[model samples]
Target: MTDFITRFAPSPTGPLHLGHAYSAILAHDMARAANGQFLLRIEDTDLQRSKPEWDALIRQDLTWLGLHWDGPVLRQSMQLTSYDTYLAQLAARDLLYPCSCSRADIRAALTAPQEGHPHEVYPGTCKQRLMSDRKPGDALRLHLDRALALLTDDFPRFVETGEAHKGTHQIDPSQAHTQIGDVVLSRKGEDIVAYFLASAIDDARQDITHVIRGEDLFDFTAIQVILLTLLNLPVPTYHHHRLIRDDHGKRLAKRDDARAIATYRAEGKTPADIRAMIGL
Candidate 1:
């Protein structure tokens, strides 16, 4: 509990489930334990999926769990300008390029059957495209190769305090090249910010000392660290907590309405019950 400035940032695309409860409670409890700050951020950057009702429901669910924050909630939609400002910074260093590849286009670009995760590594379809060539309906992608080359020193290793990956971890240059190819910064057809860029900027802006999130996001952290380093922002310690899974051992998702916090509340479950359920 040396540094406990953490946040519970949930996308307002759907309902908050038991998984959300565990993350929110864990962050809140950690901050309280250290007499530190806990912040809430509504990650409603997916304009197409984000809804006002879902945002309201998220607040309601967290409140019912008895969690409190130090200051007002910060919504990412209002921080569009900040995202743009940072994107421009990357562009200034020639570390960004315009990409026009759709999912289908990217798949077609691959010469072989790629395994593991979909969009695991971009085929670099639009790497040749320049900023001046950017047009509507094109995504802005990070030139990861250039970005890594821009690093003056070794990629920063971050400290993890969560049950999973609880140690110091560093990123290897070779792994980034073959696996995490140029990731999209802004979406096609608009200036919509992607998760890594927006979250990095928000964390810096909030002065967040630690990032507490699910291990599902553990792999992509290197990209965020890369972005933070290039932008010359302080990188925080990351704690990738274990995921709350269903009876089948599959991790919970928002679609699991049965596990939604609201559903449990309707069935008369208390906050303490939730703590026991998630093995707090």
Candidate 2:
């Protein structure tokens, strides 16, 4: 068995901000402390927004910040075939269906107020959609109800090591259906795979024993666990760390160019300074 393995996955939709450094450093620190491996994944799934220069800068920033990941970095763009294979397996089990609902369509369809723990979930307007009826612009959504049933009543659960919400949390099937709802695996024809699907598959593929990321993503662990369970892959321990926010208390974003790692580097901030800035 592996001692400890975790990953730092960032989408290259934009620059690596302070938040990215914190998560990457934390994962790298934990992996090294355990005498284990830390992996890096460039989640370049959004073909339109993801840019080559940003991908290059991500590596440069991480290297400048002194975070070293083991093995070759996994680029999601090159793994489309693998994701498709997993999609095929899920479709074979009859757990996937085509959904044609748009954001506006779902909003109009929901008469009752939604729980929306993080955001609104799909109201299953396309729950009855058949693969045969799938049109050119239909997204492939997992039949969460059917998928949950395959897990045989023992709903997905995980151990959280983050300081904020550390505990053993299990998914309530009802909550997952109503709150989480159907997760997208693939979108609009075969052009893209969803973040939830790709990350779940990559985490398992890279043998990531622990997932160290920001606390904002803590709530979404359920979907990952569910996907891993359905794929018959081992689920990893999760550690969601605190977010590095700006003066306004807003979490850092790629648009926060002032807080980007490259910005700090160009400002002559040392690696130690970077550590101090994010309170590593």
Best by lDDT: 1
TM-score, per-candidate, Cα-based: 0.92, 0.92
Model 2, backbone clash pairs (residues 3+ apart or across chains), number: 0
Query: Cα deviation in Å at residue 203, candidate 1?
Result: 0.5
| Tens-digit lDDT string for candidate 2 (31-97) | 9999999899998776777799999999999999888888898998887767888988888998889
- Candidate lDDT values, in order: 0.82, 0.81
TM-score between candidate 1 and the true structure: 0.92
TM-score quality measure for candidate 2: 0.92
